[model samples]
Target: MSQKQKILIAIAGPTAIGKTALAIEVARYFNTEIISADSRQFFKEMSIGTAKPNPQELAQAKHHFIDSHSIKDDFSVGNFEKQAIACLGKIFENHDVTVMVGGSGLYVNAVLYGFDELPKASDALRAQLNERLKTEGIELLQEELKNLDPDYYAEVDVYNPQRIIRALEVCLSTGKTFSSFRNKQHKERDFDIILIGLNTDRELLYSRINQRVDLMIKDGLVEEVRALQAYQHLNALKTVGYSEIFRHLNKEWTLSEAIEKLKQNTRNFAKRQITWFKKNEGIIWFEPTETQQIIDFIKEKLITTTK
Candidate 1:
């Protein structure tokens, strides 16, 4: 197949929606490899907490970007976009279709549409914002951002102070709306994209999330966090599972309380992921449990797209 014949299948949805299993099955069906779009799973230190594919699944299909880097290294979405593009290109050489799967909406978008390079924020401004975030609390900056850029405030992760501070820093440094830089015009790709989304009932999805969090704890998530505690300050480490436990280690909260927070935060993360993926018009949504329906849909898409 030439560039025009190449097909890219994007498996996206909320966490615990059975993306990993379905993606592997799809890859096996197409005799293709998998490219992960989950940002958290990219770090080598994060396994149980990130819900990496088990050994059996790994053996079932060739996977990329799993445990490929450390948190100590700075890996941005731009880097992910470039690397994923190259990997997709090479995989397409021998395979007609490649499967990219994860719930990380931003990372998914980065590969589908090359992200724009924003003007760098001044060091002085970033330092000031960082100090304010530490002293004044994230709520203060979140309130300010709500006032300054309501659009961004509406969509951003409010609990993540780093995101709030980074948005504000860019706004203050560039004298432009942080949301303005996000107005992207899609870049054409060499292949045709076929987006397959998986969804579940809200109640069921939340239950699955809580159960998964409990499973992570049982799988030594705490020990994993303990091993990486020295690098807690790194941006890559500032995520739901690790950050909540970091609070416990710092004595900010009790172990039990941190675990509760992790469960709640994971549920919230899933809700946000659904909301983000829902807004993307390109996604073809399906109930995850409907395996036969999904397979038939994909086969139909391939026939129509490749013809």
Candidate 2:
């Protein structure tokens, strides 16, 4: 008889979509563990802003990759893919299934389909791009990228200078659009993947995003950003909540304005996430409240796969 295939249930969706709760529930149902693919939550320094699992929720299930690295460390999607696969290997030793959850589509895809090997940017090129960012401003880089690779520009977080710079570096170095290198071929994985994407109405998701940002502020998000002020140059700190608050600290905007920008940026981020996940036809969509239905669907898939 063939051995039972170990399955990796990937819980994916936008910010404030309750992926963490659903992942924990699914892990508990399968008597398995969870691997978090949320790139923002991986750093130990980020907590309230990242919406990491609370003490009670974390204690309810075994979760790996949360607070697994220091923000000072140079972690990339490639690194995550390597580390997460190793994590899943250990997890699969004792269980037939493991749950992976996050809204970071690239990180999730890294585990599902390994990244294609691309040419590394030289230090000179990186320094040149950084210099250009310092002098020309982000707008120039954004416009250039849009002209060069409209496909990537459409989905990329335009607010993220690091991501924009990286894509530009690749485009400049290879004389090709950065999107051309993505998913050109797939890397095989040992386990089967089932993607469960949680979604709700657009207005409802926006409301949740706004409310979540408010909660983050009340929960001392400003203080958190203040603490990490020294590391603002780090790529990890360039994220949504921290970046907007950094602008406030820099006196570019009032605290109230910064908070508003935070909400707006978060909503924009969620929209991009939905766009990215929608491209993946394999994802089985459901509302966040339908936990039982998701579990049943998973079991049904497992039964069919086994048969």
Candidate 3:
């Protein structure tokens, strides 16, 4: 599909690196819409924790898949790949290029390269992994995955238990590394892909992540999490910010401690996201301030690809 006239301009990077703003700018430039690949932002129940776009951002350019589902719904990466392809088809009907932005490596890759049908684990196996999560903490499973499938570990959001548990389930059930089942062959789609990545120095990136977490708390992240206490056991609430606050609510930690943990965990998540996107050599990196340069690069790619 490299020669295809249609294009999917994928903007990828660590959290709080300005992918959303860049994608909106690109989409507005092309008079095209954005197809979000952010796995968390899809749920309506998630807001401050996910750093979803503000109303102004959504108004700037039409977006798809943001707040498009409920936390109760089971949306798999494969489901996202299938739905995103269908959404892209509609976007390509009017424009030659559309933008997809996110920090999620798995969902992004699932869209670009077809997802592999990994062998499923039995209910008992999944329960056992969840039990481990309850007793041993996510760190143990993270270490196990690191040893078993270091490739996946380097890229995966290690804090996401659903992902970690699923990978381990496959590893334990099949006696094979979970990464072994990934798609080595690229999937052909109707559109060409132009991958873009955003980043900054580690210090600045971590600072931004810390500040973002601080802002989330200021913006009522605790209130939001508290409202969803009954559903805290749900996988969507098992994420960094919410989980930290849940610990606070459960009297396991002070609010200040929870806030500090939230910042630290977010910084760690951003680091992993950088690792994941950096592995894709096709992505052209830029600072968040280099918006014009990115737009110019996109125009250049479009000309060359069309020719």
Candidate 4:
């Protein structure tokens, strides 16, 4: 393979669409290591709930960022972008191509197109705003956002209190309009990124999500979450499978009802994932089964980019 330029082969898709299997295959094809972009899979304690790769899959390829952190640690996407870039710099020294795969679009984007440094707000400020939202109604918040950051107000969903508050959070905290933080210039990187998305029919995608949820339950997902009940309040534990199981353990629902909710929530999450990835027009889409075709496509892209 030509080392004229480096390429990161990113395999992205909704949950259970075979991104891990395809990434392993591509890594083998290029004799390259894999970098996980899955945010949930970073924690060592999160296994079945995150659908992390099995021992066999890990053995197939040298992977990075899997089981790399503790759930107790506060690992933000900004931290990930820094560490992942440093990791890629080391990988690029030996190989021209590296495979990065995951369904977490935000984390993937953090590495692909680094985010601008937006200032964080105080918890007290957030609590104050949320309390205002409770007493004053969304209209007050909407009006506040419209007056505070008209540009973001025009673009954001005015009805969404969360969106309005997020904008207002930046505005009120920084004394700058949230729109100023919106369009960040893409970070300059030495390596190139070629994004490949796994495409599936909507019904098939939902079915796959449901099946994966079932398999997680069968693989002792509840036991795993139960063991981590002490840490259930952590943001990392607030994901689909674990969250539903936590509620069930709290006697909010029966086991079967929890499973049903888990399945439905996962399907909805997959829908949202698809919607998030679709916004990036650069992604080349394919069925997960099209391994050979995907490989060929990557080879062609690598050649074209090198020239």
Query: Which number leads on lDDT?
Result: 2
Q: lDDT tens string, model 3, 49-146?
A: 99999999999999999999999999999999999989988878778889999998889998888788899899999998999999999999999999
Q: Regarding TM-score, does 1 or 3 come out ahead?
A: 3
Please give the ranking of all candidate structures by TM-score, highest first, separated by commas: 2, 3, 1, 4
TM-score for candidate 4, please give it.
0.85
- Please give, for residues 1-307, the per-residue lDDT of candidate 4 as tens digits: 4443789988998888999999999999999999999988999999998899999999999999999999999887789999998999899889999999998776788888886777788999889988897799667998988898775554443433555676788999999998688437888777788999998999988888888888999999999999999997676786778878988999999999999988987887777678778878999999988999999999999889988
| Candidate 2 segments exceeding 4 Å error | 1-4
How many clashes does each candidate structure show, in the order listed? 0, 0, 0, 0
Give per-model TM-scores. Answer: 0.95, 0.97, 0.96, 0.85
Error of 2 at 307 (Å): 1.8
RMSD in Å for model 2? 1.3
| lDDT (tens digit, per residue) of candidate 1 on 1-307 | 6787798899999889999999998898889999999988999888988899988999999999998888888888789999999999899888998999998877898888777777788889989998887789767998999988887776566666777777898888877778888736877888888999999889999999889988998999889999889998788888889989989888999989999999898888887788778878989999888777877888899899988
Q: Write the per-residue lDDT of candidate 2 for residues 225-279, one digit (tens) a residue.
A: 9999999988899889999999999999999999999999899999989988999
**lDDT of all predictions, in order shown?**
0.87, 0.91, 0.90, 0.85
